[model samples]
Target chain A: MNARVTPQDSALIRSARFRKEREADWRRLEDLVEKAEKNGLQNMDFAGTRDLASLYRQATTSLAIAREISLDKALLEYLEALTARAYLSVYAPQERLGGLVGRFITKSAPQAMRRSWFYILLGFLCMGLGALAGYLLYLENASWFYVFMPPEMAGGRGPDSTTAFLRSVIYDDDHSSSGLGAFATYLFSHNTRIAIFVFGLGVFACAPAFLLTFYNGLILGAFYALHVDRGLGWDLGGWLSIHGVTELSAICIACGGGMQLGMAVLFPGRNTRKEALRLAGKDAVKLAIVAAIMLVAAAILEGFFRQTVQDMWTRYLIGWTVGFGWLAWFMLGGRARQ
Target chain B: MRSPAADVRKAQRLARKDRRAERGRAASTILPPEGVPLNLPVASIGVRLAAQIADVLITTVAAVCLVILFSALELTRPQTIMAIAMLLFFVIRVPYYILSELAWNGQTLGKRFLKIKVVAHNGGSLSTHALVLRNLMKEAEIFLPGTLLLTLDQESPVASWIALAWVAMAFAIPLMNPYRQRLGDILAGTHVIHLPQPILLKDLAGEAKPMTAAKPGAKGFAFLAHQLDHYGAFELQTLETLLRAQDKFMSPDVHARNRRTVATIVEKIRQKIGFADPIPPARAVEFLRSFYNAQRAHLEQRQLFGDKRADKHHAADETPQ
Candidate 1:
């Protein structure tokens, strides 16, 4: 036997002793983790899950002791990693897909939109300004329409194009079924892209979002001008009314969501910029989703109803009814007890 | 003597101090609550960037393959092609991130490669809601502006500048934050941390010999049952770490330094435990070794009886007055 045991010897002895006592449980826990990692926690039976939870608690206790006492670096590291993995496995939040979708639609999305009404209004004002500008510019000189609207987007619907051609494009069902489907897809994708752009660009202090929203409105106004200059304003209104109410509203709401994010960054009240942004994002993202939903509704209307409904009055009636329905839903949807 | 309540309070205070000191040492990383007891190290910006680059490269390759595939299909209508393109972007690319993160437990392929994982800031498991929110935000943060400028409007100087600005802001947010959380991470209450390095257990055969031989009735300092109860596994492990460091310092001067350290530890432990035995400076190491053995045996026995102590403080609280 050694005459005098050095602290080094003592420590080594203590570690050995400690490890010997705990190694069995640690090994058991490690084996469980390995099994869970391979086959997932679902593979474990009720008994296995219970055992895992008990073992995890024990391991966590062991980790706390190891950390507090400053155990051997390797053992400490092992416990830390093991406990973290176990915690993740044990406490993972599981939600059903249907339930999640239901919650989003019924409660979260509408609540978020209602909360950010100021931004939505601002988005509408910007779009309105853009539309007015586009209208005035195109009215003064038809050449301005070319600057704002790309040829591909115009699709031969320019100032130079005859009134009959423009009216036919909106009202006539001469195009083949496949051709209509393609047109609907094109219109839906184009509008969806703009909606996404308005929402995404809001990160840059809402400037780009405002510009994009206004640009969308400008295109709409220029198109309106093209029809109005040729005494087809009422016919164009009926055509646009079929889908424009839902589509434009969706765009405005998406832009509003973007503006909310920008507002959070610019005016963080009592919270850090990050905290503000995060809180704002909870609502903003919901509005964007709601906008996307509206876009889909609009796409269906634009695709099917706009092409089929030749009577201007019926189109107006359908458009106004759908628009009013959406307005009521937003204003009253998901309201909590006062 | 001290009253039992006083003893409990002192032990609790010491445990709290230890935790505070640990937190102070790792101030750069955000720690969960004391109840969780996790010590996660935040992944550095460089590692995060590398992981992102890898992901982007993978997605770009996939996008290219898709474009080629679609081109080969030779769909007659431009609308059909545009529709396919939109579907590819929204369905394939977006869901790739969401589903992968969900399936892989907060690690994408790139994150897995770098040994970094997204974890909940609250020390809970990653929730589905968080996964969906974060991945959905990715479109706004990185992909949307990128696609708009690079593919949609390469000719527009204004659009290009706006995209560049957006990208710059996206990158800058994480850099400015202490936790290195991007917008999505902040919104979702998640952050990426480097996975702990794998632990390789060393050969403890030689170390085990002395411990086994110096068992009960061995030539070492004797401890009363109460003294043994004063500490738990925590103190035992601390003593072990101190002893293990001796092999690193082989010089005589270092040996002298180790003795001083050993004596200091012995005195502190003796006072804390209220041990009245007078231990010689030369036999400090022997006393610690004997105490450690007795404590380990006591803890193991208690564990078998379903009365396990979490640490020294916990052991103290369990001691009969």
Candidate 2:
């Protein structure tokens, strides 16, 4: 009835129907292929859409070519190529500045914006307060300076003259031994941990807050008097300045960490202490990580290089340069990246 | 007509093309072209962004609330830690969906309520593996340079560069064209589709119940109906066309237009029926069949007795001339 449908005839009819239906798919393939050709691919990664895009290109091209002629192996190869090509296009590197800016925002937003003011105020306050305490301690009992100064430096001064001991140790480079260097490194690390803990614990506003700040001040006072008694006060100051700047700054940073923690507990903002502490801990932890990095760098300079460089003038130059350099770095260079 | 042999050769060539075409058609449903002009329903980007923001907000709020609650309760350190741990569970573990996919899903709870869903590379369901992979890959989305590689000179390569790495990773998946699923989805072997909620005639008639069955026969109708109901109107329209093309209710129609018309009519019936609880298509049809059988019995009885039955006989006999 339908034109003497034979097996072959039926097959032919079926084929015709299939071809008619597949026209849209073939056209879509062509469009994707054309788009791929226009936008060539370069770099490829496994995580994104690199392979799918390539295969799409190859498939589209093969379909396009195959549609023109009959099925051919060569045409399939073309399809493969087209697919790879299309996949590669999407995988190619994205725009550069756009990504950097995004990273800058993500990293910098919390640290600088949220905690900057508190750190600045605390750092300056500690320095000024420590210097005043040191002056008072020196004026009260000059020999008491030995309490703050390292035992080796204070003990070296004999009955001949306290000034001689101070000069020989603080101002004089001969006494700066490698053992002392190692000791300083160990002390710095221990002190750093304490500082970090203090800063971390500052949220309570009671014991940790007082202990961390007062300990720093008392140490500076004792060390200042020991040097002043030796009559090499300014010289010792210059020598300490080189690596001390970074080292002390790191301590302040640790305090900032503590302050961050302590504030969370004390103020609690709209949050309860537990919630506030946990929430604050995220940013505070990151700050601590940054502080650790700064501390380590300071340790390297203090332990290995600063101890070895001994000329008072040389030490002063190096100390001031390193100290000022670190100040500039923390205050400005870091902020600019964000 | 042309030579029978020529017709056969032409038919064979055409058949090969048709087979290829069938595969192509299969692939189309798998991955439609991105941003085609067709009124393909997609959840708005704004809605998706909003949903994501809400998820983050909820997560934050929960964390804060738990911490506060613990402090108020004077909970022990371990308990506080546990509360914090639970609050940050998603950030620490399942980062992807909460950040991007959740947003892509929709803007508001209302949109979610509306049953609109989002899919990657045209609307396809994500497989389980893909669900995990996509979420895991979000680490790169946050940390890697998403748009950085654009300005780098092709001549020089940067190591430890995240953007390039991400590109390579994405490219590895769906390389065969048209399927366009990411690697995660490919491994997971799943696709996303709007959950259907189609209403059956019986449902419209207020006599439908949620029936469960294992096979695709009568039970699958509810499944299909549910799938239709979940998709937006546009997706439902496409699905209707496909179903009509592969109609199983009766004999296949030779005319494409007629087949399409029937599908359109069925969809119209579904809209009009408005079932609060949808019934499966097979069961609905089955119910209709039983009703017809009863009607026939009544008519036959009437004919044998005193009533006229000529119209019923004619209607039954008029199948194939």
Segments of candidate 1 deviating more than 4 angstroms:
A1-12, A38-43, A136-143, A172-190, A335-338, B1-30, B33-36, B44-79, B109-114, B152-154, B197-321
Error of 1 at A209 (Å): 2.2
lDDT of each: 0.75, 0.46
Per-residue lDDT of model 1, residues B107-147, tens digit only: 88899899888888777678886787788888888777777
**Tens digit of lDDT per residue, candidate 1, span A70-161?**
33556777878877777766665555567877878667777777778889999999999999989999899899899899787888889889
The residue ranges of model 2 lying beyond 4 angstroms of the native Cα positions read: A1-115, A143-161, A171-190, A334-338, B1-321
CAPRI-style class, candidate 2? incorrect
| Backbone Cα, N, C clashes tallied per candidate | 1, 58
DockQ scores of all models, one per candidate: 0.17, 0.02
Task: Specify the highest-lDDT model's number.
Answer: 1
